[model samples]
Target chain A: MVEFTPDEMMTIAASRLLTNDDVCFVGIGAPSAACNVARLTHAPDITLIYESGTLGTAPNVLPLSIGDGELCDTAVTTVSVPEMFRYWLQGGHVTVGFLGAAQIDKFGNLNTTVIGDYHNPKIRLPGGGGAPEIATSAHQVFITSKQALRGMVEAVDFYTSLGHGTGGNDREDTYGVKTKGPTVLITDLAVWKPDPETKEFTVVSIHEGVTRDDLQATCGWSIKYAQDVRETPVPTELELNTLRDLQSRTAIAHSL
Target chain B: MSLQDAVAKYIKDGQLIALEGFTHLIPHAAAHEIIRQGRRDLTAIRMTPDIIYDQMVGMGCIKKLIFSFMGNPGVGLLKRVRDSIEHEYPSAITYEEYSHSAMANAYEAGAAGLPCAIFRGFLGAELAKVNPNIKHVICPFTGEKLAAVPSVQPEVSVIHAQRANKRGEVLIEGIIGVQKEAVLAAQKAIVTVEEIVDDFDDMHPNTCILPHFVVDAICVVPGGAHPSYSHNYYQRDNAAYKEWAAISADRDLFAKWMEDNVMSVGPEVFEGRVAHLRGAK
Candidate 1:
């Protein structure tokens, strides 16, 4: 019998969404792990960019943060942060932008800023880094997170990064964002994609052993299922092996 | 010159100081010097206030923090910063927040001697609601609304680099954040280098080099960006940061760690590279 942790399954799922030749602006944490997993296995030509000014960074192991020295040592080149945002990101060279959020709405809008009311907040989160620009400028955005009832909310407390901005074509019309906002959201329970017109997320697939009821219990809002909703492929032996190897390397990198 | 002398001379009480390093080559040794000397009423600025800022805030050095994002990086929360902001432990420190793009653009504007930076940002975010400094102005040319922020020129900028020549020209290798803009915008700058060389090999493209005239002082402090990293020199010390999360959570433990590791040690405490990432590259 094959076994895999939800974290590993989530990472493998996220990595599979990426393809070779995609210039990905990698965020730290889960996004970094997923990008490295793709680079090591499937997407070797994936140019990993970081907001820390690293371009085409190929780390031997998953970096602890974007600022890790390994990012610089293995990188093809480094640019200034302003240049990264202006020329590379806003200049529309990035193909995919990977992100994680504290909370996400059905519209795929994200909140990494605050938890409760703005003035009197229950929890003050680490504000947005380069997420707003990345969300708007990247040709496509892929979000990954552990599916929890609190995370998949009806509306994020604060919209830190614009996804579809109330669904429909508001992101393009109102915000003047040129790129498609939040193409897919990979979660532990299932995969979601925005509708072509409304832009509301609908569950397109569920992971092995995860039922629609499980997603319903975990998701904060009443989610809509795709008419063609199907079961996501189970993690292959090779994917599991590659992902585990990458995690081991990451452990060694952090230990050092 | 020593880090102690550099800090004593350049940094002062009630000054807006920016120790700008995104994640690489943070001036940890100089930060420890500021803590050791007990400088007060200082407003420290950075894009991301990591463990070093946590240490300074815990020790009651910084009166305010101007930054974009702050945390322990890969680790969870910055216990000290959260404590200061939430519980007002040691002493509550005020903070002004800005997005990463806004801060970078503000620094760029400051470097260019501009009064403010106007950019296409903060359209639908909640940051504009809280931060009074973030304002919206109508573009004269297009009649579109744009966010504007004042230039972020600091009183002094302190940074770390890979090397410097005897002529005092500093070379910053990998991941040059806003160090260049911060230094140029600052009234004065202090740079600490891993080593001082006679002649820099043909410099790499996109490398940031500060001429001697721009740099107020250059001190050779090997292993300066310890827990953080100096690219090609040493690896980031993750274990220390893990230890810091727990140590910084408790006031007494933080003080003890500082006394044992930072306060007691002099600039000579920095030995050669602890763990070089690129082995003989």
Candidate 2:
């Protein structure tokens, strides 16, 4: 049984959204963990694509980068960086973009560009790698975060990743960009989805140990907890155990 | 002023080079310059260095590559890069697990001038042993020696910064110190800055790094970083990089860009390319 951390739990919730037959555009950190966990558990059949040129890789252990040996060692195949984007991602082969962001907004928009303005930034973070493309290419997108007031913000300093900028496909509509909307947002507090009409973030469920007020207080924008919000199913002991064991293995390698 | 000449100043045959710019921070100019110059049999290290690395592999400028991610941000990974790795590239590009950890491991190790730094990533990871550039080495400083290490110290380091003097005295926003680490450790350093300042004194003394004495020369490539943000200078040209990404997908497109840009000139000519793209007079 896997005993998942709240952070890992958040990743798990994000992973649950994946299907056995998903071609996921994966990011490097938490999203990578969640996607790999899903591949290890229920969604073993999922095809994982990383910006680093690995396609359909299912490693036994988590990788440090897209170039990690496990990805190639366990990969079903690898493609060129250009092919990953043109032939697959932009070509609409990717079904889901599994990603993570430093800051999020009500519209499921992500910001990894800066903490402040785009030009005069407060903190210039790693700009969008393949994020902007994934945000604009995949048929559907899922975000994994450890929900906090700092990370889940009222607004982003810069739009590093354009998931649902402003509201209601505003980014896609105004931009003529194809791809699916940011279908889900998974955080520590709960899993949330955009309101159909307004496209604002609305809670769908509270994590096992969270509350409605908890969600409201942590949000930067006006919050909306799901009326039909159900309790997050607890991670089974097996799930917890396996995940922790994997984490420990990951920890052993990444431990500084 | 051509890539052929610019590359000669910083690179040589059989050396390893680490190109900078994270996702879209500083565009990798010198690496592209190297490829354009037609140098070969080199190795590279990166966490994620957009298409320049792919361009390097495609041009056969590299013998081996250690990286976490490589692609044209929006387009995809390079086809030749895949071929080199899968079918054996004249130079190979290998994959790893974490980006920051890889950078941190190599950066910190190089920063400290140690042989290698120990990290607890997934145990006995396969990527750790992929290349000798980063391997289990005795901590030159600690002498205590650790196992499971990843060290990335290139013989030469090329990065793009927002500002610099003609002598290559440079400044980058945020003081991430990644540049500092690279600057301190590398045998030689080449920086393509957004602007070339006349006087080092004009910039704050504290903000300055890679003193003119240590620098070779600075090329005022303006938008040298291209797809990347120029550290308080500008944001990434997602549209441009997206175009580069798409171009990377097709050899014809990539080759067209290569023939026109990379093969045409040196660092001095970089601004003209940007001007061409922007249609500036």
Candidate 3:
């Protein structure tokens, strides 16, 4: 029996959702790691696109950012920023958008804006890059983040990216968003899937160590569970080793 | 012309200037010169305002920042930018935020000489509510409501490229962003290149070459995009980004590092720092 950290479990779980044929718009940090893991292990044909204009990037190491030179060096091709956003992203060619946010609501709306007040914020977060388009344009979105009561809020202070846009097809009905909004929320403790009708996030599976009550306490909204909640599969040895190797390679590449 | 001369002649105080680079070929050397010359009250524009902008904001060289994303790339929040916004440390620098697509289209419109850029975005987001500059216009053709923002036509644009011919035409090879559009849109453009070759010999099929007529001036400055990478010239200095997180987190340390590395030295210091990365002596 092997144990893995929650971060590792969450990353592995997210990687499992990506298929070989999916064309994904990859963000930095955890999202990048998950996409890279999928490419290295199972999703070899996954086309990785970045906002920095690199299309079909096949980096040897995890990119430090969207603009990391390795992406260009190992990319199948690179396009202009306008062509990337207009033709590739908004043109509805992307299949998946992998993202991370500072705050997310039950409706799955993401906030990367301010914390307290927009006029005068307590903590000013880094604003959205390509999230607005990615959230609404991609056929589906996969969000990963650490779970806590503060992070999983009743409502985000400011919506930087549309998840379900207040749930219940509001994203499509009100905003005319073309794609199905966020399908899954992979967290350190649990995996959430939106309710088909309500579009609110509900826990479908818990990690190896977390409990139903633990999840309830951590979430800001009224929590619902699948009829028979299952435990997320423990990380396989191969998955663990592959992930660690990627991390080590990234460290070496960055000389950290 | 020298980088110093370019900055002095082309860049003016209180002008809206954009140093456009997606990730590769950022004009870090030109930015350092702006700091060295003590330019003030200028509005800085970029799609992703990275460490170079952070350094400029920290040094009080900017009065406002017009950007889509503000951060130190993969590391974390830009400490100096945060301090300037939150505490008004050096000064209270105002900002106008947009999504990546909006900025890209805005630059495109500028290049094409349009008054404003219109795109289908910000339908359900909070950006339009707070930002008065973000407007909406009903499409006459489709009667659809779409977002609009003024095109970003900078007074001057500074950028770095892989190489330039002796005739002052610039060539960029890999991961080209809006550098072409930005240069074309600016009233005046200053370019820094790795080398000034006799002529571009059979350029890459995908490469973009800015004609000398479009470029106002060109300076030969090797390793000009240090910390950021120039395609075929150097790799991004990831360690520098990590190191900057700590240094910019504190004002005293940021000032000390800037003084030691940037203000105290000339642009010539970048010449040989990345020769090994380029596979050259």
Which has the greatest TM-score? 3
Model 1, range A1-256, lDDT digits (tens) per residue?
6898878888888999888989999988888888888898888988999998889999887888887777877889888887787778868899999999999999889998878986556787887888877887789999998899889999999988899998899987887677887999999888899988899999998898888789999999988988899888888888889888878988977786
Q: Which has the higher DockQ value, candidate number 1 or candidate number 3?
A: 3
True contacts kept of 3: 0.75
Model 3 bad stretches (over 4 Å)? none
lDDT of 1 by residue, B31-149 (tens): 98999999998999998998989999988999999988888887867778888888888898898888888899889999999999888777666777788999978999999778899
In model 3 chain A, the worst 10-residue window by lDDT is A220-229
Using DockQ, rank the candidates from best to worst. 3, 1, 2
lDDT of 3 at B9: 95
Fnat of candidate 1: 0.62
Each prediction's DockQ against the real complex: 0.64, 0.03, 0.69
Tens-digit lDDT string for candidate 3 (B38-134): 9999999999888899999999999999988988888889989899999998898999999998888899899999989998788688888888988
Q: Write the residue-wise lDDT of candidate 2 on B170-234 in tens digits.
A: 77653232565666667777767777677577566555366776555555577676644453554
TM-score of each: 0.95, 0.52, 0.97
RMSD of 3: 1.5
Residue-level lDDT for B57 in candidate 3: 96
